[model samples]
Target: MGEVRLYMFQTGTLKCKYHDIYLNQGEGRDWEIPVPFYVVDHPRGLIVIDGGTPVECATDPHGHWGATADFFVPVLDEKDGCVAQMQAAGLDTSRVTHVVLSHLHLDHVGAVGRFPGARHVVQRTEMDYARSPDWFQVGAYIQSDINRAGVDWFFLEDSWGDFYDLLGDGTITLIRSPGHTVGHQSILVKTAHQNVLLAVDAADTLDHWEEKALPGALHSAVDAVRSVRKLRAVQENTGALVVAGHDPEQWAAMKRAPAYY
Candidate 1:
């Protein structure tokens, strides 16, 4: 079996209209969320899930996404930049062999260019949306780095049954849980100690998963709800540790860098 480690790369608070959607009521209170990226050190190589926001977001927040940017997300400094944090942990960016993206949102796919050698695994539907987005419906958040870097992109179309043995021992498996985006997915890592499920954006916080809540601003409200239920079912069946997309409590509990998992 292979060993796995999870690192919390970023932690920040965001104020978005969608927060109420998850709450199922319009609280009008700014939603304080935590943004984190996980690193899984399997037998194969170092694998990163969901690249956090780039450093540029903190510098030129308005320039990239304009006014709406601040409305949805507030960038955190320490955990925002992946390169800086990785270097501190003594891990060279070049060592990353694979990158699993939950979706192509600006907050998630910001630092994709850092690891040029790494193969990017994403859902084909998400890639299509990033290429040609319906601005009126969903916000445009695709970064130019994705196109600039000649990345080896692996697009999953139908299901995630193919990546059953990521760790070569049935430990780490990528679960395709579509909801937030048409191609949104989650990671199921079964470690020696426990089985952990990284529900990246599939459920923003534990509140969403526990209460079956749907964020207000989503591509499809019904689909989002369905995804949450699917994740819950997995949690029930496997008894895995369910980590939400953005939960401040979970992020705070995790060890940063040098100290992994």
Candidate 2:
């Protein structure tokens, strides 16, 4: 199989509590962590894992994200947006064939509007949860960002069980890892050299993996624990390199776009 290259992009950074991310007990220092999105250059077509915060959030922070924007206060320049990052890496954003949304959280799916031509993949449960009036996390889901035109939205059924092979080629696999949100998922990319698990909020840091700790912000602690266990099992089975969602230290050390893994 031809290797599918994975490129990392930082759409922006937002300030959140360390305790909220890692389930750590403390006063919780403010964490300015990278909001990451990935591009998979597969042989079939380009796939974007998560969109990160859109440039709109930068321009009209309060307008797009409401009070949460003010609370987290995303630090982003216009150039730090997903489209700019893809262009910077010399990839055409319009050519992005498919967009796999891990969940509909503001931080993850903010750039969903940027790829209008792409078919967006999300779990059925997540779409339902996003559209609901329930205020679970407060400012977690923004309807305007998701309910829009030109989005060829595709939802995976609950019957898919634990995982759905996105391409059916072993290039990109979506693992059903819930708890952070109702239908949260993670991506596993198989390259020629190694398998990489984009544990995208499933485990926010190595600490979560090491300690098997549920995130402080969780929908169901039981499901969170099960998701973590799934990640561990995948790691043990395939020896995949784990990339956490909001790990400050890990983000600092990763090779950013213009470089690929």
The reply for model 2, stretches above 4 Å from the true place, is: none
Inter-residue clash pairs, candidate 1: 21-216
Candidate 1 residues 1-261, lDDT tens each?
Answer: 456666556634455654433645656666566667777776567788776775666667677567657576656665457777777777767778988888887778755767868888887878887777787534545456457558888887765452444546666677766767777878887755677888888787777777646655477767877887877788898998888887777767866667765
Lowest lDDT block of 10, candidate 2: 22-31
What are the TM-scores, per candidate, against the unseen true structure? 0.87, 0.95
Model 2 lDDT tens row, 131-168: 88377565888788788777899999999787888888
The candidate that achieves the highest lDDT relative to the unseen native structure: 2
Q: Give candidate 1 misplaced runs (Cα > 4 Å).
A: 17-24, 137-140, 143-145, 159-168
Pairing residues by index, what is the TM-score of model 2?
0.95
Q: In model 1, what is the error at residue 204, expressed in angstroms?
A: 0.9
